[model samples]
Target: TATGWAQGGIAAAIGADDAPSLHAADTEAAGAGLTDPAVALRVAAEGPRLIDWLVSLGAPFDRDADGALALGLEAAHGRRRIVRAGGDSTGGRVLETLVRAVFATPSIEVVTASVHDLLQDENGAAAGVVCERDGARFRIRARAVVLATGGVGALYASTTNPRGATGRGLALAARAGAVMRDLEFVQFHPTAIAVGADPMPLATEALRGEGARLVDETGAAVMAGIAGGDLAPRDVVARGIFQALARGRTVYLDTRGALGASMPTRFPTVAGLCATAGIDPARQAIPVRPAAHYHMGGIRVDGTCASSVPGLYANGEVASTGLHGANRLASNSLLEALAFSGFIADAFDAMPPAAVLPEIRTARASSDLPAIRAIMERHVGVVRDAAGLQIAVDGLSRLAETGCDAALTALMMAQAALGRCESRGGHWRSDHPHAAPARHTEATLRSPGAAPSEPARTDEALAR
Candidate 1:
């Protein structure tokens, strides 16, 4: 669902002068030294192949006059290698293509339900899942389980992600003993349309790539004194706008000088979002602010996309594959997912089945999500200090102890943020005010379930 809502195009190295090495270099630079060089190179190389595969599956990409793929540009990239479809609606098109492929595949069956617990063997290897549908629980047996549930943006009071993006998969994984990494680095997009919407609508960075500018109330550039100006990597741009707002200034994204009347045709999705917000981009500046957009950290996965626990794997925003380190390069999330999916499939095919199996029914804990969101937005947000992080850690940890899934996930993020004392990439600490030696923050659930729980009717089979 997050993939379908994504508006930025995919990044690739298919231009005449472009190379995978160059694209990898750009990605490493943006990641601030935490990105794995080998991972970056390999993922970048797979970009063109994945795009071609999508096309073969009937994805209609925008093309130039000569019939080649029309590549656009985004910030922090040295070349124009962003591949889009239906203008700024690349994600929706890609999702539609994948859905058609899945529907035609007789081997794959789709089930809609809320997965709450992991079924593991006596040896502690993942075996299957326990799902709840219509208030009744069922156990689905499988050799392996892979999670692609997406990021934790909805944990923030203001975000561009759907409400369900609350990191439920993360809670499930953490409880199952998955090692999490870099939980501190959450990317905040600098231009989420501020129209008092519950989940804010995003104004894609591609608009700035196409010549839009960030300006304040008096028409003065908001990012004038910032390096890279309006086109900085997401973190820098977000901090720039955040500091301006902290100083009592209103920030806006002005597209009048750029796309103007052509916006409807060039960026149909954003134009429609603007129309809903009662904004006319051709005549008025779009009111904007930084809001949670992506998570650069997640369940740590190996090169094969397998987690620390056997028989369990992750993909998409739920897995941290070392491709996105401190900060993710623009338009790389979708490409990374496409590339790693192949590795996940290969890993599962070669994995030995667990000899023992068991069933576990879990009753999820409820929490005051509003209170948790307020704590995160007030403390662990765009900028942080030791005191604020401490407050966040204490507050979330309390709720986490009660087995509240949302609070447990938020607690993991807060604990990571609190441990890192330096400012780097997306985790900017106003107190530290400078970058330190780059390192990752990792976490694992120390107790059984963050809290104890009782199920209505429990049935479990244990295997050796």
Candidate 2:
């Protein structure tokens, strides 16, 4: 995971949809089809088999009353494919199992350090990573480098991701001259716990699946005019919550009547979080707000998880395989990690070894992370406009004088969001409120400030 932890996610995996859950209209709205639907379905179909594999490795799961794996909360796409464990603590539980297995394995050697950059060979292929550990900087030389450095949620002031998710992988890849696609599409979770916490606690959408509703300070339905009410798509709900907060009306997830009795058992994690915040979900509503939760855009990769840069591979949230498009479907992240991890392993085994190169050391760039994060939250957040994006661009450019990779990654996202004038899926623009012709935005490190090279047809980028 990006946080250098055993776990790689928020850990809810989606199963196959029994029917055609995705549609053309919704896809158009989501800027979907960057990844083929058939590919997503194929990976999703392997969910049961993957679950069985994990079970054999000692991971536990929670089943429904019918003895079937309990499907998690339905998403905006109208499907209930999420399968979880330890109730709301599924990610932690899953990570624990993986950690134990890894430690038990004799071949694996764990390194505790922060990676500074990707080392490249004479032919411009990834060779290894430069890292800092125990107050000393060192380089580890290898034939290939795989970056799984997580997402950029920490770039925002209010986010559910750990602080280390500063888009380091994206920065490393970009610095290595790798192509990145769709850096603009960041997904904001609709109901993060609103306590004044740094890494805010998430109020899982499953609460709504269990019957909770969103309400305003006056106890009026927040999603009253929306079609799906509280069960609406994440972007919709997030926008609504953002507008509600803008209106000075505090929003909340009213679980008092919905999951009151079952709170402690079904959602022990959430219950404990609420208790810590001095609110009992069994009797009172849980205060909530929208938060930076996931990034849909990342380092561009092909079907086999190979990046544009030879010998470079990315997996987990760091790689953009075009699977999620402008917005990610819930619980698909873990599924992608499992599938691509296997694919990359197979690919790695088949490759002929590259000659070992000598280790090279370089100075690391220092950044004012707090200032950069503030600029992002203010300009390139849930809703954006040209002027704000320009301000972000200029601010990031100034920060980039330090050669900070984090600032560079933030600049790329702001540039992409600014160049994309139309509002589509997660890249909502207050200035450009309507969708234009659908296109995939691509960029490289060479020209960060240039407009997107002429838009390409949808067929040009979709996953096989």
Task: State which candidate has the highest TM-score.
Answer: 1
Candidate 1 worst ten-residue window by lDDT: 455-464
Clashes in candidate 1: how many?
0
> Candidate 1 lDDT, tens digit per residue, 85-148?
9899999999999999999999999999988888888777788888889998888878898999
Shift of residue 181 alpha carbon in model 1, Å = 0.3
The numbered model that scores best in lDDT is 1
For residues 1-464, write the lDDT of model 2, one tens digit per residue: 53222111232334455432342233323444455565565565556577777878887777888887776665554555566776776777777788899999999999999887677777778888888898888887777788888999999999988988888899778767788889999989888899999888888777888788899879999999887778777888899899999989999899986486687788877888888898988788889998898898999998778998888999989998766788876666777787788878888876555555545544447878999999999999999999999899888877765567677778889988989989877889999999888778888766322222211211122111
Stretches of candidate 2 off by over 4 Å are: 2-35, 65-67, 356-361, 447-464
Model 2, position 156, has a per-residue lDDT of 92
Report lDDT (Cα) of residue 331, candidate 1. 97
